[model samples]
Target: MAAVKLSGKSILALLLMYVVLIFVLQMWVGPRDRWAGYSVLTPLVAAALLPFRRTLLVGAFTLLAITGSYGFGVTGLSVGARFVVIMATALSFGISLIVCRVRLEREERVKRLMVARDRLSLLSAASSRVGGTLDVTSTARELAEVAALRFADSVTVDLFEPVLRGEDPQDLPADGCVTLRRAAHVTAVAATGRETTALRANSAGAGQNREVHVPARWLDPGRPAATRVLEGGEIGASGLPMPLPSAGTGAEGWVTAIAVPLTAGKATLGLAVFARGPGRAPFDADDLMLAEEIAMRAGVCVDNARRYTRERETSLTLQQSLLPDRPPEQQAADVATRYIPAGSQAGVGGDWFDVIPLSGARVALVVGDVVGHGVQASATMGRLRSAVRTLADIDLPPDELLTHLDDIVVKLSAESLGDHGTTPRGDIGATCLYAVYDPVSRDCTLASAGHPVPALRTPDGVCEFVDLPPGPPLGLGGLPFESVTLSLPEDSLIALYSDGLVESRHRDIDAGFKELKQVLAQHAGALEATCDNTLKVLVDDPPQDDVAVLLACTRALDASQVAVWEFARDPAVVSQAREAVSRQLSRWGLEGAVLTTELVVSELVTNAIRYGSGPVQLRLIRQKTLICEVSDGCNTAPHLRRARTYDEGGRGLFIIANVTERWGTRQSRRGKTIWTEQALAP
Candidate 1:
């Protein structure tokens, strides 16, 4: 229950009644009568109107008035009356003292309650202001600002270097010296008026704003109270003599300071220092306890942010390692690519692109996206990219390549279900687009597995999306994928991209396509320029998903750069094939390569006629490398094996491999094409 307060009017009335009673008692019964004891009420009433000290003064004055009335004999009194007046005076003085003590105790209790309320308010503010972000720097700055505004006139936060880098804390030095990086510093505007000179000096030569270094012995366990607090993960107070590099010369105005350790679990990450200027009361026990609470809360937030940062960096590194370092160079097209990962908060996504060089002067352009983010998605992307390259090397058509990829994804999903006993949602799903451009035929064949269609820009700067059938995304079985073939003019631009470039929350896929077409038409100068301009116009902020874009400008080989011939199924045509190859080389001014070319043609034709069927053909093309191809009507592919010194039957393909830079066989509609490439003369 609340204490009842006496009004000024009531208190005055009580004092007057006490005086009247004294006068009436003295007038009716002598001044020293036994009823004079009632005058003690005068001093008790005064205690309600005045403070403890003033109440004592009023009690002394009333006692003197009683003694004077008896000493002057203002009324006839016996010895007993004198004794009664003395007793009443003594009782009033003692009772007034008791009343003053009670009032003082009540006032002290109210002050404590107010202090407790303020501390609770500070703790609430700390919880709301700090740890609101996963960024270490931002969290530290917020902690400092809140402390300075609510608890102290100035605040500074310092963290170990490894802690700032999202690493676990190391053991403290045995020699009592510690190294710390100043992370945040904030002061009350009214208290500091301007930036401190020491802060300015510390930041003058620092490379980053919050990375100033401070060396101090105060962090040692035995140095001072503040140091003890840090070493023990407790709270301690200190004077200005302690080393505080963050405060610098501004420490002169700091009359009292408290240091609390920022600890997460068993590790100590840093320290928070709160300081009060002159004229402010020094931090008491309650203040130190409150500071410790704030530090503990902020510590957990900082540690959580650090852990998140570390995980993000790890994911990014894994994704980057999985991506191709550089696109392969091919004769059919010039390729340029761009890849940007999502922000740290969004984590890393599985977006990848590749340029694979195929046989017959054909180049494969690929862009793919995995459904989720983080290391698992990146690992899946790597596996899929490897599978695609392997399939492309075997000369699979674009549609067949995607079919094989879909089978792999379905197998992966099944394996995941077997391992975890639950079907994953969107985890194993992926989208991809594969395109093969043949310069010899001046045609491109493309296929999509639930991926966006590519954009094509003609030599005249007109852009449009390729109309292709969209198949089910990878990981879904029993789906048929179809391929679309289009004839592109020489110098035409073809762009393959992941959906991140054309889809966002605010824009639909069709709107994204329109913007892409506009950008491509506006900047159609070079492959690299087109890629840069497309990303610049399409991505104004950090995309929600990873982005991968690949641009290639097509170039076709003219009729003069190629030669073709058809031969009968007779073994006698081997010599005819060699003669045709030599004449073609001479006409193309590759006379220096004629002798080796004749040998290569002789071995290839002799084998095709000996082990193969009828209707053999031969072709040669001039590009970055001179390519010689032999096709037969048989489905069998020849292999290269080491021939015994005593045997001559299995040395034809071996001899071709040694005389040329490289050789391979690819299956064609009719049979297989055995091809060899030799480096052109410098």
Candidate 2:
């Protein structure tokens, strides 16, 4: 009966025609027969076809026909039989009305069951579709498609800006005005008298559903039901859906619309508005309920996506901050670097790099990677980076710096230990490569802690990894780090990178190394360009993990810019050292600096000679700044202290500190060297 369906008016028309046919039959048969009683069939037919109200109308017409049979002067029956027939006809009409009421009630139940089954199917579809992804815009598109397929003709999804950024949204404002971004606008296609879900951004074209960012505008709470729903946190529906400001293509000719707020807990995320077109029936209460459910389901998904995006952004920011802003200004190398985080969905990893200026015109290039993702890994990277810098400040070698860093990592893991201590705390482990490049000797000293070997591109455009003694990864205590020192020619490019650049799921580590070499082999002119092009070739749009690269072009000081002299352990060499320094300054055309250089040479040479050591040595280097260094075999290092006014001997070291821009002492295998740097005029 449901398959061959009819509206109330159609059923009423059929009943009315049945009544007319019964009247025709009464007229055709003579009054001699009780054929007028055949009109009773009309009421029975009406019971199956029409509602109680229209059934009563049909029965009334049948009653008129039965009684009007008397107009034909019925002499075929006596008055008692006529009255009995009239009574039976009246009784039959009353019974038909009761039957009509019961039948209508049962049909109403069946319709409600069908409606419930469809709603369940729709909600199930929504749960499987909209709830699968933790992406805000994708969820919005799925909701729009599911809602518009059968229940609505057009659907619009709008969300708060912060929620789109993956943060919890603020409560609706007191004035009910809130900023919203149009996340999706989907319209259904009506074809072949059937509706199915195919997402359409506009009737002009169709494409993948992406986040829609139009000019930012406030939703008007007083009108245009989208905002009204957000204000009241309820569904807004009317005979004709309100016109949306940004409604597109298939949204026209809509006769029905409903706006529902997407709310989770006490916070309202945004709004969803659904519409129906001219050909479709106007929305009923059941549709309004279903729209609410869809909006509610979408709210939960958007909230989840919002939280995820917020955490990822925070982690990336922290990770970048923990890393370098730009390589510091240093003369040891011309530096350029690049850092790219994993894609939006994949969490941020702990990949970091730093360039630290070491003593004696040297630069330490450090790159490291931790095992995990998120804030913890980034924080650990920061801690290790800071530890490396602190050790470098004390003039530790590359191997010793990594050695201390390993101890720090071990301590960190030990501190995070749980009651069952088999697993190190946070599952912390890291791989690091530390390299120190000296412009004076043109030698790059490198050490590794289970890290990938760095690549070196020669000035002649040859690329190869500078292999070293690969040590155990940090956190496995008691492993000694080994240092490798190799000669780097001038203008050679040294690349320090995290394992992310050379580790892929589709290929082995060797393949990634081959690609890295290929990229570095064909050099771009600028270090910045080379770094960028390297990433473009090796990195995905959103890389699977964090990638960090640090590149430096080597520079060597010319022999003409440096002077070294060795003298016996005698106070007489101090004056000779001052004369030699004056001549060297004159040769370098730095004649103006001769007097101050003489004073610095005299003070430092005198200290090295009288400090009770073996032979004394003096070395002067000219780069961005003029460096004066004096060394000896004395195990004792000098201290700059306040000398008494009457004391002349102790003032030698103090005067050197006052005359130079900066001064410090570093211990070498030969002894200790007290070095001073004075600024040279630009």
Best by TM-score: 1
Please give the CA lDDT of all the candidate structures: 0.78, 0.77
Per-residue lDDT over 495-600 for candidate 1, one digit per residue giving the tens place of the 0 to 100 score = 8999889887778888899999998887546678778888988874778788999998899999999899999878888888888888899898999899999998
What is the RMSD of candidate 2?
A: 6.5
* Number of residue pairs clashing in candidate 1, backbone atoms closer than 3 angstroms, sequence gap of 3 or more or interchain: 1
- Backbone clash numbers for all candidates listed: 1, 1
Clash pairs of candidate 1?
32-81
Please give the lDDT score at residue 325 for candidate 2.
Answer: 84
Error of 2 at 472 (Å): 2.3
TM-score for each candidate, following the candidate numbering:
0.78, 0.77
Estimate the lDDT of model 2.
0.77
lDDT (10s digit) by residue, model 2, range 38-61? 666778778887878888998888
